[model samples]
Target: MNVMPLGEKLLIKRIEAEGKTAGGIVLPDSAKEKPREGKIIAVGSGKLLKSGERAKFQVKKGERVLFSSYGGTEVKIDGEEYLLMSEDDILAVIE
Candidate 1:
């Protein structure tokens, strides 16, 4: 991919969940929940502090993370969908 992530941002691809309810019911298109889980594909270098120092990002590439459903901008690269968001938008890293 030619696109590069910058400035403490992340490039993430959302994980596809089972599109069904627990009662063996297949949910409609609109009934699907917003997936909060995803795998991080790329991470920014670091954040620049006010004192001219860079604060490194904690999340790394290939790490699984949980993010807010309302966060991020959807982008398509090379026919693949991805979410571009700041590191702060990530809720937590999934173990």
Candidate 2:
């Protein structure tokens, strides 16, 4: 399914966290933490400014990014998990 975010929103796919610890202990699903890293799946047009000019986005589709842990609404598309959030919720674009 195709998705388009409106007005500075972004669609992201979370990067899976490792299932094992450095000690070789395998972690169960219950012990896993939701990953804060994700890849941009889709991006909205720039935010609208008071002057009617659109603000440019610092990130783009296909870019890997870091976001606040509690940010974004969870969504499922075609059985896959995704995140929808505002650009302000993004902490940084991973280089």
Model 1 lDDT tens row, 1-95: 96678887899999987788888999877888878899999887778799988788888899999998888999999999999999999999999
lDDT of 2 by residue, 1-95 (tens): 89999998999999999999999999999999999999999999889999998899999999999999999999999999999999999999898
Off by over 4 Å in 1: none
lDDT of 1 at 17: 76
lDDT of 2 at 7: 94
Among these predictions, the greatest TM-score belongs to: 2
Candidate 1: give its CA RMSD in angstroms: 1.2
Count of steric clashes across candidates, in order: 0, 0
Cα lDDT listed for each candidate:
0.89, 0.96
How does model 1 fare in lDDT? 0.89
Runs off by more than 4 Å, candidate 2: none
